[model samples]
Target: MKQKENITLSVKNVSKLYGDGCAYCAETDAVLDKNVCPECRTVHACRDVSFDLHSGEILGIVGESGSGKSTLMKMLYFDQEASRGSYHISDYDTSQSNVFGLSSQAKRQIRNEILGMVYQNPVYGLEMDFSSMSNIAEKLIAAGSRNVGEMTGTGDHFLDKVNIPLNRKFDPPINFSGGMQQRVQIAKALSNYPPVLLLDEVTTGLDLSVQADVLELIKEIQREMGISMVVVSHDLAIIRMLCDRTMVMLNGEVIEAGITDQILEDPQHAYTQQLVYSIL
Candidate 1:
């Protein structure tokens, strides 16, 4: 028998609601208008979203705008607190504790040492006014690196891996193009070599050529570094290129999930079928 793959990250019943939910929202018999509770107008950004990311796996979350995919990504990165959920990283405390329940300090440590995030908007992930090298150094410093030489070396290594020219490393991200800014964000996210990487629409606004290059870079990183990644993108083409398995989210709920090829070839959900066919 084949040995079971280790689960790098696990989440159970994760939810993020923007308003106080009403009893109707909790009733299985009640109808919801999209992801909103009509009775309370509570925006259920993510309702019971859960998944397991295996070692060295690239899992994709795909959905249209406002489908809660970004919200789920934010919750995974601890950028947005989950209202209810149990999140555990196998490499952290043997996955015995729900990270969401940890103290702010502990969560910060986890963010620095275990989880790395690249947001859809570069503004959320990069310090535009800071030099590209300084942005990377900031992450290293947070992860407990105290030696300037070591930090500088690490920053150079990652920036180079992402194809950012050494000569421009000292320049601020504000001086770079959108694609270059995203590359700097990627370097910063990988500076500490976190075991799990969360990417939320990282290629959203880039030109087609740039998007392809970014996606290729992500694949190279995963292959060489063995970093398990959770990639969120609405574009099915991007998912097809980067993900091994995929989950389709609609109205804040995962409507279907399975191996990426299976979903592309035989999407079961109506929304998912529409999504897959639209790209053809």
Candidate 2:
């Protein structure tokens, strides 16, 4: 990617393990198949994962199912806790403090004001039966927005930005098609004007045409908003299209990461080579 810009988000030695880890599992050199330790029977969903997100850039985490890419996104969004890790965002606590150590309230504030997330499933990000505008308002309200008129205006602005018709702003998302629902989710996520956005398989399961539209919307949003993004997907094609840099995860570990084009053209790790070649 272009010259390194200011670091917007940084993660260090992040891990998530299930089961009580024994000495064998604790060994840094422990051998595990598919992230499961044979000796201790513990599952390491993510082990010592690390990465950085630069301002105005999109970082993609690509891996197959059970590769722990989604688990990493969950930890960053606080949907799940990291067993061990340090998360620092430039907009939070001067970017020096580890967010994992913060109180629940502080984390909520960070989620509301500093970071926005778009889940692959709109159900997780939207209130299906609530007005689309209400969904956006909910996030604004969580960020301490009290002025109803202003919140509504912000809601309208983002809805329009995402191509959600203003006329349907009061309609429940349940009444919309899948692509439209995803659009609403995108609108709600960006309504906060967050410095960072996390997208987990945002185009998964959409029709090919619809997928292209959503992908275009995302790129346009990043270009116009200048928001840093971390996008997680299992598809190499999606990663190639959307990311400035790419990280390939396997068996709960990042085996390769670098400029998207470089990784695509010249992947170093065997697993990464397989992924790149499969897409070609």
Candidate 3:
């Protein structure tokens, strides 16, 4: 795999606020506390989050629940609108653009052609009643692929790549086990070969054995495809296994970030140290 030196995705000064910015909300830096004003009642889902993802790199954002890691991922994938900031993908242009400024049409194009997302819950990513092949084909159709034969062939290829049985290609995901459903989700996300992939707690809720297998599959895909990925998870073990660099989030703010090994072995932040030790 050829990993480029260029920056792939750049996010700066991103925040997501859920309430009208009252005077208190405007002046107070409540993000570190992830607090809501007693009077204004604002929820800062993500606060001033900034990071650069390099080409062919897997960047992990790790945090406990309500730490805003998922919120940040949602902002990147356009599932939630950021209150402020610039988001730039080098493939789109060298100059940074305010992603929220783009029209709905433009965002849709970006989602279809430039980004792929695998949600934590299979239901969020897969159409349960649809066959495994159709689930993958839907993404291709959205990207303007029309030939049924080509779509089916492409679907089969990815299914095989993810180690899904070819015989089950026509079966609905509802009939599959938890691990198999996730494999189907992975196949669908990669069908278009997008430049960026967003995975949110991808292996959470799986059996330990299944989690290991899925992690190995993810590693294999990264090795083969060289796609840039933002993996959001609370599991430090998973982060250590998959990411080149890591960012530690706490209460809607990034408290620490560095190479994965450094962050895990020599954590400077109290929260990060606690996380690393808990796993040990």
Clashes of 2: 0
TM-score of 2: 0.97
lDDT tens digits, residues 177-239, model 2?
899999999999999899999999999999999999999999999999999999999999999
lDDT per residue as tens, model 1, 75-170: 888888999979988878747899899898988999999999998899999889999999999999999999999999999999999999999999
**Which residue runs does candidate 3 get wrong by more than 4 Å?**
1-5, 28-33, 93-95
Q: Which is the winner by lDDT between candidate 1 and candidate 3?
A: 1
Off-target runs (Cα >4 Å) in candidate 2 are 1-5
Higher-scoring candidate on TM-score, 1 or 3: 1
Q: Write the per-residue lDDT of candidate 3 for residues 1-280, one digit (tens) a residue.
A: 2343488888988888888757766664533235465667788777788999998999999999989999988888888889988898876642467666888887877888889999999998999999999999999999889999999999999999999999999999999999999999999999999999999999999999999999999999999999999999999999999999999998788999999999988999999999999999
**Which residue runs of candidate 1 sit more than 4 Å off their true CA positions?**
1-5
Clashes of 1: 0
Sort by lDDT, best first. 2, 1, 3
The collision pairs in model 3 are none
Question: Candidate 1 or 2, higher lDDT?
Answer: 2
Residue pairs with clashing backbones, model 2:
none
